[model samples]
Target chain A: MSHSRLGRRTLMLAGAASLLTAKSGLTVPARAQGLQPTTSMRGGANNYRPGAPIVDRIGGGGFLMHGTVRRAGDGAPLEGVRIQIWAHTTEGRERDARSHGATLTNADGVFELEMPQIVPAFGQPHGHLAYDSGAFETVFLRPVMDSARDASLAAHFVLQPA
Target chain B: MTLKHLRAVIAWGGLATLIMIPIAVAANSEYLQYRGPIYIAAGFAGIVALAVLLVQPLLAAGLLPRLPIQLGRVVHRWSGLVLLLAIAAHVVGLWITSPPDMIDALTFRAPTLFSVFGVVGMWALLAAALLAAIRKKRWLRPQVWRFSHVFAASAIVAASVSHAMLIEGTMGALSKAALCAAVLCALIWTVWQVKPWRGVRRRQNSRR
Candidate 1:
């Protein structure tokens, strides 16, 4: 067999082996269990809006993504550049936990802000750690379902070199 | 790759896909599909990787001597490789699926203990793999490399178990907790069985 074909065959066999080895009884145990719905969302209603720029200080053991956005070529901090942030929960359920926003770079093109939590308003508990203070903080960023701009570009602030 | 190597690779790859597929399919079926599958896959992959780390050293030192040493070595090395792949899949798949969560987990902004543990476990596993890959370099003494390997692997297992325990979703609270306990027990067993520290103690005592 060709190397690629051999590789595919090997992957298949490994899958079979793992299936055979897995605790055979978990299928029923897995399916019988149901999703624990969160009531905290207040009737599928979301209060958070998308596309508002925010800069959170996140000093008290909280969610802070502190960084400086600089020009890619010159390595100079891109002052006053805007940075936006937004995120959704794992379940695709948009709620208050994924609040989105944007903030301008400070004099150094450096911005410090607490990232909002992405946990559902009524779902599995989420955590935010303050990278600034080294303590875990519990807070929720409102969830986002749809937005006009790229979330990555929203979160990252980069300066174009002159 | 040799026939044997090919077989091993196939088996590992197939198994990972099989385990992951149903969950992905199930997610599409349900309203909260993506959430359930991603969390479960991440948790399961971490647990399995922990199991590999917990089980291997004992098999290498204890069972290997009793059985065929070469066979034991093969299992250890291959499974270790599989564990690395599983972790890679867990992170890469998740990254592709959700860039925000990946950033959150990597940056330690995940909401639950599970995410924290998962991230930390990933780092530990990475460190251990790095040591293993570079063990033969002149700068790294064999003894130092061995100690670092054991320490990093142990950290990975512990963090993974913590992660498994902390997640809540389709796996059900009880089953998820049980998996975590089982993983912890396996970790403890491996540590006790290998007793890598015992050798250090013996050497020190002998000198005394």
Candidate 2:
């Protein structure tokens, strides 16, 4: 065989051998599971509070996450509720030093958050929000779908009093 | 049939079969079952990337017997383009599915080691493609381009292999490891046979 032909044949044999080896079911020991979070949930944790400046910085394609924080028993809007909103951006984490902060509900117990463009990361196109009030149970909202295109997401927090 | 023709048929058949493994494995993986369309797309993209990696070195080294060296060069260029597209699809799919992790990976803040390796590999692959694209227009010396190409290729192979090995995801473990090993061996073998370093040394000696 010519040198070129020989090289080709060697390549073919290597490919065949690799395929056969793959099919042979030579298993490696399985690693311990459950250490890593699902790709969507990774880096989902955020404790940064949103300030007025941060909310002002939300630009086009941004949406309002506005809803009443109500008491679970009688469904009355609860006042002075602290709400934190964070979502993925094209740059970095929403709650990173560059874009970190939170807001509070008004006397009517209505809170609104201006979210940046929803760029999905980890698992799906989603965002994170949390509700906290001194007299009520704290609620962490995770992997909230970015439904901005349709309508503003009304994430009502029905908290049980602590 | 002539012996040579028979040999060609077997070789092509074997190569085709080898190419199908990653695609088949991706389609059948349990992790992809409940992951929705975007995730499934990413899985398929990753499989295509791996498959491209397998063929690239062979084409570059002109190891495909039936193809003339000129044809091999054409195929290699097209393969490089396909590889870039596959990688772009993979990253976009993953980004749509999960922004935080993708952000972490891109920003080099990802906690997982595999994410770091994957990001580095991706950048290296992109840089290699860019370098190849601009080589003629930039009037880069052949020796400089060759060295840069080899360095970028080495980074890509090393980082991608490590990234794939550490992640236990959609790919079948046995097939994934086998394919990775094959790719690494082919890259090392091709680089060794080409002896790119010799050109660099010769150029330096002439410059002295």
Candidate 3:
């Protein structure tokens, strides 16, 4: 191909790319942009508060559930909040109170709980959690880990006041 | 087995390995727990669709040893149909899992950027299919059809690769990246071999 032909094609490609990028930018909503904090995800909040009493660990400890508790909008970390967690583990199913536990967030809003490795039941390995402190609007999160072999899963809460 | 059969086996086996490895890598994903059967089926359909991309270019270029070009073309056509069904299942299954999310993705209101590229790819694939289906109508001349098909194919690859790369979901990062890279290479090689651009310019010159 001639140099001018190649150069023109390159210029045309560059022009098309810029146009597409500009068009994509226009698709974002005006007021709110990106993945905003929602009330709850679909399939979330199922079987919340099934009479599981507070415990430190759910069976033999091998995996962890950890995240920060932050207030909505301004993202202020809230301390001393109780987060309830459950999963179908080698020890028990999510329905079993023995598979449930709760932990309080530290002063930095960080919370971590040791739990047995979640065993996949219905679909894949996952842990369910709820912010049960009543200070914030109840948010039930069912977080799935990236890998079954991973020892940790994170479910952060950005809460709205009740 | 004869050398001919061995080459055929090697060729087909290599392609199948490329297709199957990514699915195996993604099987370890924990997100599969919450997904329903339909959703899982849908996920597989999409994964397979991506994998089958390797075959299309090979078939189009007549690069697959022991496969006749005529047979390869027929397989290419059927695979295109399968791709359409897989994509439909993927969308419908996701819709069943979460209607609002699927609707957002379909309508371009989805909050995540991945949905945008995915939606773009879906439409491009659909357009390419439509173009292929009407290739007999002669609405577009052969050169025009070839150019448009190549354009649409490129769009589909670009969009799907972007969509796959953005989502931090089931796929293993390295395997997914490798698959995406291999797809790009196959497509580039096929297009280079076919030299569809040269045909278009030559046809225009002949017409003048």
Candidate 4:
């Protein structure tokens, strides 16, 4: 096959392959078109507390959920933003009022809240958080713990200005 | 090119296809970066094994173009051994990565739906591999061996595909599904053509 001919053939084959897969279905990219750079992940919004209060730290045996909150447009850090957090912990399930709490982002857009050590609920160790306040569009997160033994999980959020 | 060379090229292409799927995942997947090296290897081993399976049934039924059925059988046996080893590496690597999780997986205590299917596939593969090792045993009739191996093959493919599908991992969903579908198609086609259920009748026909 000549260089141009071979290239055309390859392109056609690639197109066919993509069309076949696209018709079959796309799992990750199908929902990606509608999402912000940092948005609520699937299952992230589950078990969110609509108005959980900001506290110094939740009942703590020491697992901290912390991350930076950035603005979606310019990536600027947003301060005083409330990030509500909860998890299935030794103390209680994620739905339990004691297991849920909120923390405010500081000047640098970093927020951290100490809570009871998260245990695997339904065989998955995960924590849920939501940016429930009016400052930004609501974003919820369910970050799986690296391991049940790990003492912390970091969940960063980029908020779109409402 | 001569027909013989063309056949050889096609045969090698099958192997290349098997290797490329895992390479694509390892090189491009965002999830793999977060994983430890051992865990990554385990994940790749599973991917590689699944890819290899695409060519397996083709070889067994002598459908791969240009290769003789006898040589294909030989390659099939060797590939079977590779499949066994790859699966072993995958399980062992995972165990080293997390003993508690592996235990949960093995004991069916894992909450994740994938673990049960994985366990089933792994055990089925073990059973299939064992059948080959005991091929010469007097108690093991050839007919029985063939039936059991065929049964095990389908179980392995079904469970392994389910396990792979359930995982949200390094493998691209489209490519992963394509590879899996190819493997299933190859297996079903081979089983249908081979028709192990006709064992005695087919053998008797050949005797004449």
Name every residue pair that clashes in candidate 3. A123-B33, A124-B32, A124-B33
Candidate order by decreasing TM-score: 3, 2, 4, 1
Q: Model-by-model lDDT, in order?
A: 0.51, 0.69, 0.77, 0.79
What does candidate 2's lDDT look like per residue over B1-208, in tens digits? 8987888798677667666876688678655544569767886787778778877877877876687778887999999999999889988988876665678888987656778888999999988998989988867678778888878988988998888887756677787888888779878888887776755545444645
Query: Chain B TM per candidate, please?
Result: 0.67, 0.91, 0.90, 0.87
Instruction: Determine the iRMS, in angstroms, of model 1.
Output: 8.4
Off by over 4 Å in 2: A1-162, B1-11, B202-208
Docking quality (DockQ) for each candidate: 0.07, 0.06, 0.07, 0.03
lDDT of 4 by residue, B124-158 (tens): 99998898788778466677778788889889999
* TM accuracy, model 4: 0.56
Worst 10 residues of 1 chain B by lDDT: B25-34
Residues B40-155, candidate 1: write the lDDT tens digits. 46545644564465456645554322346677767777787889998987787666545565676788765445678888988898898787778767465555566677789789
lDDT of 2 by residue, A72-139 (tens): 65667767777777665433445454434466788888987665545433433456666544576566
Candidate 3 residue lDDT tens string, B1-208: 9999999998788777777778997786665664557767777777887887767777866878988889988999998898899889888877775565577678876556778898999999999999999999999868889889988988888888888787765677788888888888888888888877755655444655
True contacts kept of 2: 0.11
- Stretches off by above 4 angstroms in model 1 are A1-162, B1-54, B64-67, B138-142, B198-208
Q: After superposition on all CA atoms, how large is the RMSD of candidate 1? A: 23.4
TM-scores for all predictions:
0.47, 0.57, 0.62, 0.56
